[model samples]
Target chain A: MTDPKKTVSVKPDADQALKARNGRNIALALGLVAFVALVFVVTLVRLGANVGNRF
Target chain B: MAKPAVLSPDTPADTVRAARWQDYFQLLKPRVMSLVVFTAATGLVAARTHIHPLLGAVAVLCIAVGAGASGALNMWYDADIDAKMRRTRGRPVPAGLVEGSEAATLGVVLSLLSVLLMGMAINWLAAGLLAFTIVFYAVVYTMWLKRWTAQNIVIGGLAGALPPAIGWAAAAGDAPLNAWLMVLIIFLWTPPHFWALSLYISTDYAKAGVPMLPVVKGAKETRKQILLYSLVFIPVCLAPAATGLGGPLYLAVSALGGLVFLTLAWRVFRSDAGDAADPRVADRALYDVAEAPAAEAAPAVEGKRPPPVGGAKDARNLFAFSILYLFALFAALLAEAMIGIRALELPL
Candidate 1:
C-alpha cells in the first residue's frame, strides 16, 4: 500500500514547473503586446504625411 | 504577484501541470477567426469607398482579435457544457489547461483593446459593431440563447455574420445595402451548416444537454429545416449578383455551388435516420477482397468501425460543402472587387 504522505510529496516539482511555464507565457504575451504597440506607432508616423494630403 | 510556494527537497513529481501558451491560444478559436477575417476583408474591399491600406489592415486585425475575444469568452462561459460534450472536452478551460477565470479575463481585456483600437483607428461605427458582436456572442448567445433555444446557432449566427458589416462600416463609415445582403446570406447559411453537423453529432449534444436543433426537434424535423434553409440560402447567394456586388464569375460559382449544396441537403433529407450501412464500406471491403490471396488471406475483421452511414454521410458531406460554399462565394466576391467586374444592368 502507498503512503498518503508520499503521495502528497509529488506536488512540489509539478508546482515549480507550472510556475515556470506561467512565467514564460506571461513574458511572451508582454512581448507580443509591446510589438503590436510598436507597429501602431510606426504606422501612425508613416501615414501622418498622407493623412494631411488626403484631408 | 505571489511567489511560488517553497517545497521540501523530498517533494514528489506529480503536481498539477500549468497550461501551455498554445492552450491559451486555442481558446481563441483561430479557425473560426480565419473565416471572420476573410469575410470581413471581402466586405471592406467590396465597399465603394476606398480606405488606406494600413488602416484597412488594422481594421481587419481588430476584427480578428474581437472575434477571438468572443471565442475565449464563449469557452469560459460554456466550460460546463463543453466538459460534457466530447467535441469540446479538450478545450482549454474544460481540459484544465487554463483556469476559467483566466480565460474570462483574457476575453475581457482583448475585447476592450480591440474595440478601443478600432474606434481610434477606423471609426466609431465599426468599433460599436465590434463591441456588440462580442457581447452578442458571449452574453446573448453563449450565456442565454444557446442553452435556452433550439435555434441557438440560427440566432447566434448573427454574431458571426456581423463582421462583414463591421468591415463595411469600418471602410465607408456606414454599411450600404450590399453589405447587409452579404450578412443576410451568412445568416441564412449558418442554420443549415450547423444543423447538418448537429444531425450527426446529436448524441454528443444530447449527452451535454445543450438543446441543439436535433436534440429538441428530432432528426426528421432538423433535416427538413436544413433543406428549407438550403433552398432559401441559394437565392440569397444569387442576390449579390443582382446587387452588382457579384459579377459573372460570382454568378457562375454561386449557381453551380448552390445546386450542389441543395442536392446534398436533399440527399440528407431523403436518408433515413439511424441507417448504419454506408456504400463506401462495401467499396472498401471489395477492394480489400480483390487484393488478398484466397488461401492465405485472413477473413475480414468483424464488428469493425462502420463507415459513415446514410444520413451521417450526407450530413458530413453537407457540412464539408457548406464551408467550401462560403469560402468560394467570398473568394468570388474578392475576385470581382479586385478585377472591377460587375453584372450588366438592363434599363427598364
Candidate 2:
C-alpha cells in the first residue's frame, strides 16, 4: 500500500518525462512539415511554376 | 529600494532578476510573436514602399512589441481557461512563474508604450491599426468572442492578420486594397486552419468550458463547418492572384496549396464521427506540445475523458501543419513582392 501523500504527489521525473516527450513530438511534427514543404517546393520547381514571378 | 538583508542581500540580485525576466518574456508567447513579426514584415515589404530602411525597421519593431504586449495581456486574462487546458497548462501564468496581476500590468504598460511610439514614429493609419489589433485581440477576442461563440478564431483572425498591413501602411502611408486583400485571405483561412485543430482537441476546449464550435455543435457539425470554411477559403485565396499583388507564381502555388488544403479538409469532412473512431487525430498531430505517445494515453483520453477533453489521433500533426500552412502562404506573398520589386527595376 502506498502512502496517500506520496501517491498524490507527482514524481520528480514527471516534468522531465513530459518535456522529453514534447521535444520529440515537436521534432517529429516539424520533420513532417519540412518534408511536405520540401515536396511542395520541389514540385513547384520541377513544374517551372513561377507563381512568385507573375506579379 | 531598500535591500532586505534577511532575504539574502549578499547573493547577487542579477540571478533573481534574470529569472524574473525570462518568466516575463514567456508570458508574452515569443514563438507566436515571431510569426507575427515575419508576416508583418512580409506585408511591409510587399507594399514596395520606399522608406528609409532604418525607419522601416523601427516600424516593424513597434508592431512586434505591440503584438507581444497583447499576448501578455491575453495570458493574464485567460489564465483561468488556460490553466484548464492541457496545452496551456505549462504557460507562464499557469505554471505560476509570473503572477497574474504583474503580467497584466506589464501588458498594459507595454501596450500603451508600443502604440504611442508607433503613432509618433510611424503613420497614424498604421498606428491606428496597431491600436485596434491590440484591442481586438485583448478585449474582443480574448474577453468576449473566445467565450461567447465558436466563431472566435474566425473573426479574431483579423487582428492576427493586421500586423503586415499595418507595417505596409507605415511604410507606404496607406494600405492599398491589395494589402487588405492579403488580410482577407488570412481572415478566411483562420477558420478551417483552426477548426481542423478544434475537431481533434474539442475535449480540451470543452474541459476548459470554452464553448468552441465543436462543443456546442458536436463533431459532425464542426467537421461540416471546417469543410464550409475551406470551400470559402479556396476561392478567397485565389482572389489575390487577380490583383496587382500576385502573378503566375503566386497563382500556381495558391492553386496547388489550395488543392492540398481542400483535400485535407475533405478527408476531415468525410471521416466517421461515430463513437468508436478516434476523432481527435487531427488535433493530436497539430498541437502536440507535450508529445506523449498518442497510442498509449490517447485511448484513455478518448474513452474516459469527457467530450471536452479527449484529443483525436494525429491532432499534433494537424496542429503542426496549420503552422506550416500559414508560413508557406506568407512566403509565397514575399516571393510575389520580390517579383514586383524586380519588375519595377526593369528599364524599357
Candidate 3:
C-alpha cells in the first residue's frame, strides 16, 4: 500500500501551464535587467567624463 | 493503461496552453525590423555627424523598437485577415500563441517607450519622426490603406522608407536632400519588390480579400506597373553617386544591379505569372511559412492552391533579386562610408 500524500498526481495541462508561466517570468526579468543596464550605460555616455561639471 | 481521470479529452485551451516570451517577440515582425535597422544605420553613418557611439546605438535601437511596435500593432489589427492567408496564418496572433489584446498592448507600450527614449536621449526631431512612423504604419497604412485600395503597398511604403530619414535626423538634427535621396531609393524599391511577390501569390491575397494590384487590377497590369516602378527606381539608385552621397562602388553596384533588376522586371512583364485562376505550386513555395501537415498543404490553403509544374519562376526570380539588389545597394553605401571611400561627382 502506497501513501496517497507521497504520490501526488498532477494534471498534464496544469504542469505545462506552470512551466510556461515560469519561462515567461524569467524572460521578463532578464529583459528588465537588460533595459536597466542599457539605461545606465547610456546615462554615463551622455554625462561624459565630468560627473560634477554640470548640474 | 488507464487514462488519467483529471486529464480529459476536452481541456480548456487556456489551461492546455500558455504564451511564451518568444511569441511576444514574434509580434514585432523581426524580419521587417532587421531591414529597418539596416537602413536606419546606413542613414546615421552617412550623415557625417559626430554623434557618440552609444547614443547612435540608442537611436538605431529606438528606430528598430518603433518599427517592431508598429508590426505588433499591424498583427493585432490584421489578425483576422492574416489568419485567412497562408503566409501569415502561423503568426503569433493568428496561430493563437498570443492574444490580439496582448499584442496590441505590447505595441502601444513599446511605441510610447521608444518615442520617449528617443526624445530624451537623442534629439526631438528623430523622436517626432519615429512617432509619425508608428502612427502612419498603425493607422494610415494598416488600418486604412491596406484593405481599401489596390495601391496599398505603394502608399504604405512611406512608413518603411522613413527610417533612413529618421536616422539622418538623429545624427545631424536635420534631414537634407541627400538623406531624402536614401528615402527615395526605398520608396521606389517597395513597389517592384512587393509587386513581384504579389504576381506569384495573388491567390493568397485574393483569398484574404486583400486589394493587391494583381488581385484588383489583374496580373498583367501588376507586371506592367512593376516594370514602370523599376524603370524609375533604377535612376534613383544611380542618383546617390551623382549627388556626392555615395562613392564609386555605389555607382558600379547601381548601374550593374539596375540592369539586372530591369531585366528581371521585363521577364515578369512578359511572363504569365499572375494569370492563374488556380493557385500554383509557386503559391505553396511562396507562402509556405507554416509547418502544417500534408493535409493542410492541399490546394488553396484550406482550399489553398498547390504548387504548379511551371511558369512562376519569373516572378519568383524577380522577387528574390529585388531583396538582394536593395541590400547590396545599401551595403555598398555603408561600405564606402565605413572605409572612407570618396564619392565621385559626375559632370552633369
TM-score of each: 0.84, 0.73, 0.87
- Against the true structure, what is model 3's DockQ? 0.41
What's the best-to-worst order under lDDT?
Answer: 3, 1, 2
Residue B154 in model 3: lDDT:
94
Candidate with top lDDT is: 3
- For model 2, the stretches where C-alpha displacement exceeds 4 angstroms are A1-55, B1-19, B273-286, B289-319, B339-348
Please state the error at residue B304 of candidate 1 in Å: 2.4
TM-score quality measure for candidate 2: 0.73
lDDT of each: 0.81, 0.71, 0.84
lDDT of 2: 0.71
lDDT of 3: 0.84
Candidate 1 per-residue C-alpha lDDT over B1-348 given as tens digits, one digit per residue, 9 for 90 to 100:
211122212222243345567677888999899999999999999895788887888899999999999999998898888876656766767666577888899899999989998988788999999999999999999999999999999999999999899999999999889999899999999999898877766776788889998889888898899999998999989988777678889889999999999999999899764233333333232113223233123454555533335566677778878999999999998888888887533221
- Residue B289's lDDT within candidate 3 is 26
Tell me which residue pairs clash in candidate 3. Answer: B280-B308, B281-B307, B281-B308, B299-B304, B299-B305, B300-B303, B300-B304, B300-B305, B301-B304
Best candidate, TM-score: 3
Candidates, DockQ: 0.27, 0.02, 0.41
Best by DockQ: 3
